[model samples]
Every structure is written in C-alpha cells, then in structure tokens.
Target: MTAGAAISRRALLAAGAAVGIGGTLMPARTGLARVPAAFEPTQRLTLSAGETELRLLGPDRPATRIYAYDGDQFRLVRVPRGTRLEARFENGLSEASTVHFHGIRMPNEYDGVPTLTQPVVQPGGSFTYRIPFDDPGTFFFHPHCDETGQAGRGLVGVLLVEDPRDPAFDTEHVLCLKDWRLDDRGGFLPMSEPDGAAKAGTFGATRTVNGRVHLDLTAPAGGDVRLRILNVDSTRVMDIGVEGAEAWLIAIDGHALPPVPMDTLPDGIWRMGPAQRIDVQVRMPMEGGPVTIGDYRASDVFTFATIAAAGRVRRPRRGGPLALPPPKLPLPDLKAAEFHSFTLQQATDAAVKDTGLPPEDPLAKALIDSLCVGGATYWSIAQQSWPTGEARHLPPPLARMEAGKSYRIEIKNETRYPHPVHLHGHAFAVLGSSKGRLPKHFADTVLTQPGEAVEIAFVAAPGDWVFHCHILEHMETGMMGWFRVV
Candidate 1:
C-alpha cells in the first residue's frame, strides 16, 4: 500500500501492452459486452453532465434524454493504485451538482455532499476534485445533489484501481451493474413516487451493465479471469454468481479477502447491495465454452453477462491465485474501543421524532420543514430525519466523538429490506455478525442483510462525517445521519 509506484493510465492501456505470454492488441471481448476502452487519465480528466442519447428502445425510436458523465454509456475507469485521482467536473444539467467518490476516503473538503462539505456546483459551472487513491479495489462516482433524479437518470460510473503487485490474472472484465426506470421510446418514468419511497424504495424496470440490456464478453481459453463487479443500482440488491466455470471469491468492497472457492459458500453466490462490489475469479475450461455471470436475487435468475471462450488454450491448468495484497489501512485498538448501537428501518406510524434538542437558524429550519411537509418522510434512524428534506437543513450530530478514539457500533436493521450502509470518512473493521464470527475486512460500505445486525469497529477521525443507506431513496426519505469527530 505504499504510495508513488503508480503507472500512468497511458502505459496500462498501451497498444502493445505486454501480457503473460504475448503482446496483446486488445483486451478479449465476448457476448454483447465489448472490451474495456482506454481510460487514459492524463493528470486530470474533464467530465461533464448533459443529455445524451440512450438506446433503451432499440434503433427505431429517437434516443432518450438521460444525464451522463463523459458519455451516455459508462465504461471502466482504470487508474494506478495510490495515484491522485484528479478530475474537473463541468455541470451541464439544469440543476446544481457535485460528484461523490462513493467509497474513497478523500479529504474532508472534497467529500462532495452539497451544502455539507462544499457548495453545490451550479448548472453551467464547474468544480475540480482531487482524490488520493490510497487503497485499491472497486469504487464509483455519482452526483450527491438530487441523487434520486441525478443518479436515477444514469450519471454513474465504476472506477477501478489497478493493483499491479496483487494476484495476477490472464485478464479481467469490469462490470458496472445497474437498473433503469424507463418507459416506451426510452423516456424515463417518474424518478420516484411517495409510496415507493415509503416502502422498498423505488425499483427500476430494466436491468443493465455498461448501459446495455445484455452484456456480451470474451475470454481466452484455458485461462483465469478476474471479474470486477460493482452494483451501481439506486435500489436493487443483486445476488451475483458465475455459471459454466469454477470460481473463487477474491475481494469485497475493494478489500482483498482470503481466496475462498465459490463451492464452499451456501449456494455459490454473494449478496451485493447498492454501492457494494465483489471480485470473483473463474477458470475457462481447456476444451472451450461460454460462461454466463448471473444475478439470482429474483425468482427467475438472469444472466448479467456472457463470456465466450476463444483462441487456443494458452494455459492448460488454472494454477493457484497469487499472494493477496494487504490494504494499506490503520489499525484500531480493539481492547479500548467504545461501543454504541443505532437502528435504521422503515418508519412506522408510531415512530418517535427526536425533539427538544439544540436549535438551528430559523430561516434554514423553516425551509427544510416546508420541504418535508411537501415531500416524503418514509424512513427513520433512531426516530429522527437529518435535514428533514434537503441537505440545507443543519441537524445536530447524531453522536460526537473524541478524535483518535476507537469506537464499535452495532448497526441493526429493523426494516424488511437489506441496505448497503455507507460511512463517509473512514473504513471500519466488520468485527462480528449476527449469524456468526466473520472476517473483519476494511470497507466504507457494508451490506446488512434483512433483519440482521452487524457489529463494526473503527478509530474516530477528526471531521464531520455522515452514515447513510446507499439506496438513494432511503437516504432521501430518512435513513441518513451524521456524527462529528473532534
């Protein structure tokens, strides 16, 4: 995890980039999934938001108007691990916007929460984000302001940090899993309804990866592949598994785990909630065939992508995995850790409203209160809604902590649906679980299964930080709050 061994994106995707055996012309492709494009980040990248053409309805009708960064369709964003991720974001949409590095622990000033970390980048304006990529794994970037509309209309992308020293695979495929809510002619339906937000949040009608209805991919025969998969869905939970090949679970939420074979798991699948990531490796048979990566969370399992085998068998045997690299993260003093518990779930009629606490500026409070009255307040955490509606409302911190202190929190989900819970600043060790003991890996976001509780511990960093549900609607409704570390 040392800094400064970074390779420029240009070198990584050079035309004659050397592979295990031969100089590759391009990354192998299969099915409807095309090969990953060159994400050449030359010091800085210029990303803008504007209406772009979408082919959700095929070639007959006009392209739909959907917001996007770089292009209407998103692809893999590759950068060296431990490099400074610098980008200038231009807002071309009709509203204010800011980009949130979904899982990166960037500086407090560039965290990108509108009115909380920095002022929103207004329409026609621009802002530059400088994030240091200390840890490598799967992550994403999307707008934080008006997320229900901003992200729901498509503005999402996957950022992959290249770990050169980590376990080497023949080649890897990057899958940005997402779902969309669109009508005939590829027009977007309503972002969300009050009823949908009040319940399971809003679910999209169409599922996709890299902006396509079905992803087609190709891999070399008799070789190992690393599947870098991300769930960018606004609300849907995906159960991911690979078919037609033997696989191993290598990482989760960007942190490398012990290489566990998929056959050891209950049903050879990993449950991924919104904003979560899972890396799996599969071996192509020596003879040759096609493999389909799938989502089985629904009653009828569906293929997320298809990878066909091509060419001659380069490597006859799929050997053992390379030595897993350790994440460069700080350690917490578990013996001296303080413990606290919090509950988040759907709001009931008898939900308790936190009252008689510290007050805020009257005008700001009034505006937020008015918005809450007009909009929805469908969820709650400890019986209170932070900001009530928009990020403008300044609510009191849910809890204040002394800087450098180790803390353990038991986050319990009382709702029926699982949440991809995210903490803003620091990564935590997932100490234990409701079902059994667990491997405590470092993660900014953790998937809490329905009606299950997980205990996580971390050291308190000095800053104002937030914790919320990654399901955008849940956060908009009420499943969001913040704590201050002094």
Candidate 2:
C-alpha cells in the first residue's frame, strides 16, 4: 500500500476508536465529546524558541537580533485534516513561554494560556502538545506569555490544515504580514510606549511580508492562484486589495465562506486587524503580467508582495473558489441563547488596584525587562481591569455558562481606536454590527470599530477560555478577561 494510504487507514482507525464508530469522529451533543485520551500521532515535530539574527533592514545593514520558532522566520506547518498531531515546544529564551494555537477549536487543555490551561514553560523547559486537526483551514501560532515582546521580535509561524476534498489550485502561497520597530542601526525599539498603548497600541516602523522587504512569486498565466494572508502584526489594521487581477475572498479566520467578489466589498478592499486571516483566489490574466497585492488604506497603495505570470497561458478555472466542507461544530440555537454585553473602554484609576508588592531587585528587574513585562494598565472590559504583576490572583470570571448552552455576546467598542477582540476555544458567528453591514460568518476574532457594537453567538466550549483584544499591548495592560464553562 502507498504511504499516504497507509496513514489514512491509521487515522481512520484512531478516529473509530475515539468515537466508538468505524468512521470519522463526529461531535456528540457537545464539541468536546469526541476527544480521545491517547492516540498515535500522525505527525510529530519539534519547535524551539530562541534568539537569532536576521537582516531585516537590508543585506548591507547589520542583522537584528530577533526571536523566532525553530530559528526560522517563515516556518510553515502543514498537516492533513482529521489527523492527530504532536508538537513539542522548547523554550530557549531567558523568560517563560507557551505556544498558543491561535484559531483551532479543540480541547481546552491544549489552548496554551498560561495559568489557565497550562503552566508556562520556563527557560530550557519543554512542553508537548497533542492537537487534533478536526477542522482544516488557515491558522497561526505564537507565544501566549509575554506576547508583546516575543511576537514583536518575530516569534510567529503559520499552520495550515489541508483538506483533501477542497478544489486544487494551480499555485498557492502563504503570506504573513508583520512590521518591526527598529532603528537605523538595526537595533530594537521599545515594544510598547505608555502614551501609545494608552490610545491605539504602538505600531511598527518597518513593514514586511514574510520577513522580506519585497516578496516576488511566480505562477502560470490564466491560472487560479490561492493566497492565504494573515495579519500577524501587533497593532496594524490593513485594508487588503488586489491590483491587476480579479480576486474573490473565499475564507475568513480559517472558516470557509461563499466566495464574494472583491469589488462588491467596501471600496474594493477587506479590512483586517491583528490576528485575522483571509483566503483570496486571484485569476491571473491571460497576458503575462504582474499581479500586485497591497494595502489600500493609505492614499498611496503600499504594495508588499507581487506575483508574476511567467508561463504560457492555461485555461482559467470557471466560477469562484469551491466551498470547503463545513466543520463539525455545534450550531448555536439563537432562540435560546443567553445574552450578555460588554463595553471596551479606558480604565479608571479607581477601578484598578495597585499590586502592592516589594520592588524587584536589579538582577530580577533586568530579567523582567528583557522579557518586556510590567506595563501600566490602561484598558478594561465592563469596568474590570486585568490584574498583573504581584496581583497574579485571577479575578472571578466575567461570565459563566453551562456546557452545550448557547450564548450571544454584544461587544461595544467605546474607545477611539479599533479593537480586534479574540475569544479562545470557540469560533463564534458574527451576527451583525451596529455601524456597518457585517457578513455573517464564523471567526475566532472580530474587528470592532470605534463606537461600534458587534454581536456574536456560539455554543459554550467547556474551559476557562480567555476573551481579550488581539492588540498585544492592550491585552498585556488590562483589556483581558475569561469565561467559565462547566
């Protein structure tokens, strides 16, 4: 038998044992019912987090010291859908770290939030994660502990779960959009400034696509090209658009949607914030030419990447991208869903408690400074600020619900800047927005504009799931909370 077929058989057997059926594992009443205690992993890999030098500014400039996974800036992890995979993470940095699988809906223990799901891996420590690839789509991973510092220095990687049933494309590319805060000498700058974090989180000075100043790729003329784009920036919002080609958006935040033409959207561009992703299919023109993908938010289009059509013309695929199979997720019963509301705004001094602890010694403070901790609190949710430093005692959950119950949450962004709110362990369906028409779709993160109220609903996933802003600086300070699901 072929190796691929052999692995497929093993995966089938594992799924059968997990669900007590000789077929694919299906969810029983709730999302967590099909989890297995132990199974042979279809794939296993090791990722080490450490500091490395990268010539991000230019080849002639000095290399900047950055943190990355497995010592690579553009590492991509691809696995087949419905398979069990194992990832062992080693922390080589001085501070603690944990890899959070950003948008996969799985068991709570593997969610990777420090102190909530699992303890942080200290320096030279290692942790293994057994993840079930039940849903297939575009996702990414990064350090959950001290994210502002680690991710800002380049600790990010893309994870793609390939679905065999999806239509094949002539060419495909993954683009990770990020920016770096650096000086002319290729030295690092402070990740978060107090004044900047207080309003809109601090932004990067240098922009890049996949850690390059300019990325050039090639494809055949008149072929369908799939572009999986992720905004891995800490605090930059992008209005992505395609130039010199006809493109359609087929997926958002790792979930497939009915393809929509780019021109039909607002101003022919899609607005994406931190931690958000979109899959677009572009049709290369019959004549050999360059197709540009850029951010159109500013007056001058900032072209970051380009794909050149070099080969002879091929017959173009008909129609938009084929719809991917729906994931095995419980549908929320809107009629019976419990309702809750939260306001995102600046925190008041009276609402925040000073963690009255003894000052750290110089030696200890230096270590903490290297990890970029001890930022001032500035934002809050529902008037409650997240406790930091000596106030490690977790506060009561913002809300609680029974497993298998449906809940609808209304998040109102009262602050001046936009907030990309992210919920862990569940993909909520965005119902609507008060300011603009939002396409109803399932996503783990949603960008809420200033003075906008966005509503989302989902069946509660059992765990202490964190709900917070995706902007790292804001989350680090005070704009974070959790929900309890029994």
Maximum-lDDT candidate: 2
Number of colliding residue pairs in each model: 8, 0
lDDT of 1 by residue, 276-312 (tens): 8888888877664698899988888878799888774
Q: lDDT of all the models against the reference?
A: 0.70, 0.79
Candidate 1 accuracy as TM-score? 0.85
lDDT of 2 by residue, 56-123 (tens): 89999989998898888957899999888888888777566778899887777777776566655666
Q: Model 2 TM-score?
A: 0.88
The window of 10 residues in a row where model 1 has the poorest summed lDDT is: 1-10
Cα deviation at 148, candidate 2, in Å, is: 0.5
Q: After superposition, how far is residue 234 of candidate 1 from its true place, in Å?
A: 0.6
Q: TM-scores of all models?
A: 0.85, 0.88
